[model samples]
Structure formats: structure tokens, C-alpha cells
Target: MCSNGWIRAHATYYGVNDSPASLGGACGYDNPYHAGFGAHTAALSGALFRNGESCGGCYQVRCDYWADPKWCLRGAAVTVTATNFCPSNNNGGWCNLPRHHFDMSMPAFFRIARRGNEGIVPVFYRRVGCKRRGGVRFTMRGQGNFNMVILSNVGGSGAVKAGAVRGSRGKTWRQMTRNWGANWQSSGDLRGQRLSFRVTLLDRKTMTFLNVVPSSWWFGQTFSGRGQFL
Candidate 1:
């Protein structure tokens, strides 16, 4: 403990899968996972605010909503949630409830050949329009800096938006993040090739963002990669 009486803690955690079933009591326990990597660091420690658990709000008292054009009001000084893990109507209660989108697809034959064959691997980006459902959590790690994650999108003109998703608020602790991204990971049958994208909500001050979903092409192209599209 420091002279100020603030106690510090450190620990390590392992095991690949960190699911809600595993972390039940903790706040924002479901869909617990690491950003890109770091099984131990993610479980070690950081800052934890449960789903719907908030200290008043991320804002002070009087602030403007700059994250969205619809969010207009000089209400409370809260962090205009560009991304939210709390069980909130992120789109403001039905006004906006759409999954993060990324549009990209290849013929089923080509998709299979790409993942299964591996010889002709096609690498591209798909923009993640938004988060899937509320509780679209974020698992962050590291202390010295923010955990980096890239959100690749496939644009019409064939452009890739490269960026990283980070958890900056929780930096002091060794590493900790407890968010539940329930609807973020879902796969089912589609009409044609599932061309989708993954959006990584990043700090513009540090990272970038992208979109996913449109024709739903790459949804089933590869269970290995697409499975973790969340």
C-alpha cells in the first residue's frame, strides 16, 4: 500500500476462453475476452464497471453530445459514449439497435478456397458499422499503454480502414476489463456469400474505426476467423 493508504494488487490469469458462465459474480462478466491477445493480462487487473453499473455517468455534469448528430443536448457532462459496455440502449432505446457492420464477400467457392486452401488467401478490410447488441463489451489489457486492435473494413472503392480498439480509462491496474458482448458473436445461414465487417471502436486520439455487415457474405466463410468477428 502506498503512503496515501491506496492499496495495489497484481495477479496473472490463464485459459483461452473467458465466458460469462466462468465469470458470473463480477460486473460485466459475460463475453470476457482479451483484445487481440493476452489471456493473463486481461484477467490480472484493470478497471471494472459492470453492465449497467456506472458511477453516475462518464460525464461530469454539463456536456454536449458529439459522438452522434442525434445526441444533442447540454445535459450532463458525460462521456458521449462512442462505445458503451453498460446494458444501455446505446442507440437510445430502439432509435438505433443495429449490429456493427462490415460489408465484404466472395463467392462461396472462393471463400472456401481462401480459408480451407490457404494458398490463395485474400486479405482485406470490412467496416464495422456499429455494435451488435447492447453489452457489446470490450476486453482490454496492458498498463504502460492502451491495448491495440485493428478494425478492417472493405469499402466499395477497395479501401481498408486500419485502427486499434483500446481501453484507456483502465490503465493504472495491471490489467482488467469486464464487459459482456453477447450479441456481438453470432453466426447463421445466409442467402449468398456472407460478406461482413468488424468495427473496432477506437480512441481517435490513439486509434481508428471500421464497419461490418451489408450482404452478410463472410459470415460463414470461415468458422475460425469469422467466429471471433466480435
Candidate 2:
């Protein structure tokens, strides 16, 4: 962290300006808009991605106008959701380890920098609370004894640290392991049962979404909870 809470970093942009091409990413938010992230999203470097644990996290980023006045838009900042990863490149890319960087969507980058900044700019960023429109959502996938759920629309700390699932027929909650990105998996056969979820956020607050998934739920269906992290 920088002295004043902001951390020094570099930023670049990818995909078309505000287009759907920027939607899906490594975080499994195939359609960020549908996942409640909108187009204001970014791909974090390995230093920040934390092996996908940083997915759904929010950050406030602004170009360092004082450091690069010619390319930065003074006082302009944008809050973006972490939805992708900026992999390390053998050619010593900006996203390489030890170098904090943000691969932002085109629209997000342009918000804080001049259009012709050559795709990169000095930046300062800080984690911020995610202001989602609703309670946390769970998108269900997989079949039979294998269950995969993707958590989204998270608020507060935003990123989920851990999760557990309990079916109506089960007396105890079973821990769900991280499958990939924001997807959590469980080998329990939870078919034809109402599902409750207990999610722990990075802040250590656990919110239990009781019976968030109905017994009639099907694959590829998303269920919304009634509670959200503060």
C-alpha cells in the first residue's frame, strides 16, 4: 500500500471500448453484465489476482496525473471489478510478478487517461467496497454427484474467501472447494433438494443464504439470495 492508501501501479486496456468482448474472463463471469459487474471491469496481474481469490473484488483506480500529466486525466478515477487475469509474459510484461498492474477494459482505462497514452499509464489504486445492486447470486452448473456453483453480485469485501453448501436432506454443511476462478465445487449429490449456502468473505464475515436454490433448480440456473454483505 502507498502512504495514503493508494498503491502505485501501471494500467493498460484490452478488448473493444465498452463492448461485450470484454465481458467474459478468467473469473468465469461469462457475461459481466449478467454477473452484475457491468463494463467497468479489469484484469488484475498475478501479484493481485491471488490465484483467483481476488475475483469479484473491487478497486478504485486513477491515472497518476502528477507523474504523467501529458497522458493522465487529472482527478479522474474509476471503480472496477476484478473479473480477469493478466498473465505473466516471458517477454517481461507489465503484468509480470513483482509489478502491480491493472489490465482494464478500454472504457475503464480511457476514464482516467488520455486516448493516445499508448495503451499504458502510471496509476494509483486501492481496494474499495463493491456496491452491488442485489444480494449475492449463485449460478449452478455440473450434474449428478458433481456440483459447481459460481458466486457473483457480491458486495462489501466482494471476494469470497470460502464457501459451504448444505442441502435440505443434509444435517450439516459441506465445504466447497475452489474449482477455478470464482467457481466452487462439491462432490455431494444435491439433486432435488433445496440448497443453502454459507459464504465467507475476505473480511471474515460469513453470510448464509438459506435455501437460495430451490429443489426444482436446474443446471445453468442462477439463484439470488436475500442477504448481502455490508
Candidate 3:
């Protein structure tokens, strides 16, 4: 377990009582509800946030004792997904912590920390392969002549660094712009054509899916790709 990459940090929570739409942060995720939960999501500070590049990345965190010796998890750890950013302005300067800090959800923090300890706990964390249940999903979100696609449920590296699209009859791959979050947009019309995508993970790994979107595909539709980044 110590062989993988890891970081030391402090943990905290947000949206503990009610879920906010912005829980998806700047990633434009279609599943804000899950992002709002403490069990599966976390917020990273500016350093670890990687300018949103860490979106969808997964990590396993174990609490380290700093204050009261009475509350300690010993070595318990919990896994969480990168779903939001923890701005430096929050809560007295904890978020302003070094690049290694993490502001986790209550459920995630509780899972590693003892029953109570002023809500702040030191932790040892490391990036881990995201465990997705099925194939990756591409959700279409544009008008008739334009295309804005959101990539989600990606396994492994999680966030996408670059992406391209090609029409059923086209030979060249058209680059897509990272509009925000996981949403990528094409500059031209892609109507009447089945669509394929090529994605580059943050780690520089690449994957291409042919005809993942059928010619009959419409705006707001979602299609499942047969493969995922390992």
C-alpha cells in the first residue's frame, strides 16, 4: 500500500446538511448529487486541484493524529473522487494549506477520523485508480448544429487532458475545446454523422472510440463507450 504515490494533508467538509448544485464545482458534472456526498467526493486545494485537471481523480485517505490523542483512526482509510475545488479563502486558511492538503466531505473525513475532533484531521493520501462499475459515458449537450460533450464515469486517470472527434465519413480527427469541467465542444457542425472520439488522459495515456455516437444521436443524449482508460 505504501508503494503508490501519497501526500500528507488536513481534511474537512461541506454541503453536510444540504446539497448544492455547485457541488460539481467547475467540472460541469451531470451528477452533482453524487459529488455532494461525503462518501465518494472531495475538494482539493489550488496545488492538488491542478487547475481542475484533477477532476474525477480518485484517492485513498487515512487519518493521522495531530491534536487530541483520544480521537484517532489508527490506520483506517477511505476512498474519494475529486469533484470540486477548495478555495483558499475558506475557513481561516486551512484550504490555503500546501498542495498536499485536501478538504474532504464530512462522510469521507469521518470514515478516516475518530468520532469527533473539531472536524479537522491530518491524513496520508494517495492517488489510486478510479473504480468505475461499467464503461465510460459521453453525454451530448448542445444544439442541432453544434456539439458539446461531457465525459464521465471514466476509469483510471479520471480527468481528460485533451480530446478529439471525427465524423462517420471523415478521415481527420477534429479537436474539441475544453469548455469547462468535463465538457468539450466542437467548432463545426456534426449533424447527420455518427461520431467517434479520441481522448488523452492527464497521464498522457490515449484512447479512441469509433462510432460511439450514432448518426441518429441528438443533443442531450448519452452514449456508453465500450472502453475506458486503465
Top of the candidates by lDDT: 2
lDDT of each: 0.21, 0.90, 0.76
TM-score of model 3 relative to the true fold? Answer: 0.87
lDDT of 1: 0.21
Best to worst by TM-score, what's the order? 2, 3, 1
Scanning candidate 3 in windows of ten residues, the lowest lDDT window is 30-39
Clashes per candidate (backbone, < 3 Å): 42, 0, 1
Candidate 3 local lDDT, residue 34 = 33
Measured against the true structure, the TM-scores of the candidates, in listed sequence, are: 0.22, 0.95, 0.87
User: Candidate 3's error at 213, in angstroms?
Assistant: 1.3
> Which wins on lDDT, candidate 1 or candidate 2?
2
Off by over 4 Å in 2: 17-21, 90-92
Model 3, CA-based lDDT:
0.76
- Cα lDDT tens digits for candidate 1, 81-111: 1112322232122112232111111121122
**What is every candidate's alpha-carbon RMSD to the true fold?**
23.4, 1.9, 2.9
Error of 3 at 78 (Å): 1.2
lDDT for each residue of candidate 3 in 91-122, tens digit (9 for 90 to 100): 55877846466777777777777764676767
Cα error, candidate 1, residue 11 (Å): 2.4
